[model samples]
Target: MTSPTLALDPAWITRTVAVALDEDLGPAPGRDVTTQSTIPADAVGAADLVARQDGVVAGLVVAPEVVGQVAARLGLAVPSVDQRVADGTRVARGDVLAVLTGPVQVLLVAERTLLNLASRASGVATHTRRWADALEGTGALVLDTRKTTPGLRALEKYAVRCGGGTNKRMGLYDVAMVKDNHVVAAGSVAAAIEAVRTRFPDVTIQVEADTLDQALEAVGAGARFLLLDNMPTPLLAEVVAAVRAVDPRVELEATGNLTLDRAREVASTGVDYLSVGGLTHSSPILDLALDLEPLQPV
Candidate 1:
């Protein structure tokens, strides 16, 4: 099988992992009191991160980083993590996602941190996969919104990509999105689009439209991307057709109250994307656990 490639920044992984470890173990010179009290200093063991349910795997690469940071805090030898599966790969229940070997205390200390990141990422990926599957062959892709957990945006967005969903924008900086408020402030959709285009000429501007007139006005004002907010299928199709006629290159996305049951119907309207906030905001964690086993010192 081909190795799955995950394009997460090393620094982002390191920084996020450090923060998560701090949360669990507390500030510098932190300790997992329970593990420190029970496990012997010289004791060494191994464990396998096992999947408790079938789902797409993600964040395995960050496991070793978590182990390393945990070991540093506890002054224990860092564990060697053998990743059995790559990120984005589908796995069944009971699959061994990775193996860890080191001081028993280190394993115990890092267990929750490892499972938390992996499980959450896998959950988003699994949830996104459903949308992707539903919209397959509809000439539309599932897109993730900015409605992600703060500080976890990069990781969660990466998980979205793993599950075959596209990310809309990294944040407010990359894309200038003129929502209803912006339209109200600037007087109209055209005015809002023009203001953003004038101020940030280099950045791509997307306008949110609640009506066909607004959608057309956005395109006329030079917006190549339009966000159709909460429109029913017929009206959504109308906007799509109108936008295409104006500029076939003007990409359209149908957003709000989207569900798997209606994914195909919405995509069938010829919108370029279906942006779902639930992919990150409401996905449940995929169940995973670290099963520890005693091992002889190598």
Candidate 2:
């Protein structure tokens, strides 16, 4: 069943930098003057795409053939996009998942672009999945904050969903999050909530608060959701409990410094959502590679 709260698979935000890279870097050099003068042109080679780190693979479909396009442009027969690579699975270093059979020069030229997309997108997916798994067994769900790459928001958020995370408000207009600065600029939490409510009453107004009093104040002021920012776990528990006692219907979420180790502990507080920025900003890449298999002989 789809969770009533978080939506996933908004795949319209596809990242197609692979085509861009191929367009920029011309077809692989057929005969390198330096290579031919020094080495034989008939020296063909093949290499397997090996994993260098442990991670949940993601974006392999789009990642693999990028180099192939580069190789094809360079006069090499590149592989297909359908070349199979398992995704969302854990892998160790030195595991061969793809084999590229083309001119050694083509492989060498295409190497960087292939690895660049693999590492970067995979990192985002893996981190996002961790948040999804962290809230497992609890009714809570993991959400990715808007703290994403500037132009890559759509693709990055797509990767988050691929990792099983729920994407929060995509932009400022999607949802109304009454943060500290807004509250301060408005001179009060009530004022901040009122401004958003006045303009976009139908929007989901999530107000961030530091103390139980602020949390309650936000609830009393009709915040649809409350974000408890930078509060201690114990204090978070108290605030949640207090909020429940006063207004059980108000949704609560926790943000700020939410590391993986502290995930379950905080989720145990009965907060509805946990927002993490690491999924995009600081996540390590997913390990993946694209290697071509030898074409079958007639």
Error of 1 at 264 (Å): 0.7
The CA lDDT at 180 in model 2 is 80
C-alpha lDDT values of all predictions: 0.89, 0.70
Question: What tens-digit string does per-residue lDDT give for candidate 2 at 106-148?
Answer: 5665666667656776688778777788779988888888788
> Over the stretch 1-298, how does candidate 1's per-residue lDDT look in tens digits?
0112447888998999888888887886687788899888879989999999999988787987888888888888899999999888899999999989988998998899889999999999999998998998899999998899999998899999899888888898988999999888999888887788788888888888999998988888888889999999999999999899889999899999888999999998999889999999999999999999866755
Number of residue pairs clashing in candidate 2, backbone atoms closer than 3 angstroms, sequence gap of 3 or more or interchain: 11
Strongest candidate by lDDT: 1
The estimated TM-scores of all candidates read: 0.96, 0.75
Residue 141 error, candidate 2, Å = 2.4
Candidate of highest TM-score: 1
Worst 10 residues of 1 by lDDT: 1-10
Each model's backbone clash number: 0, 11
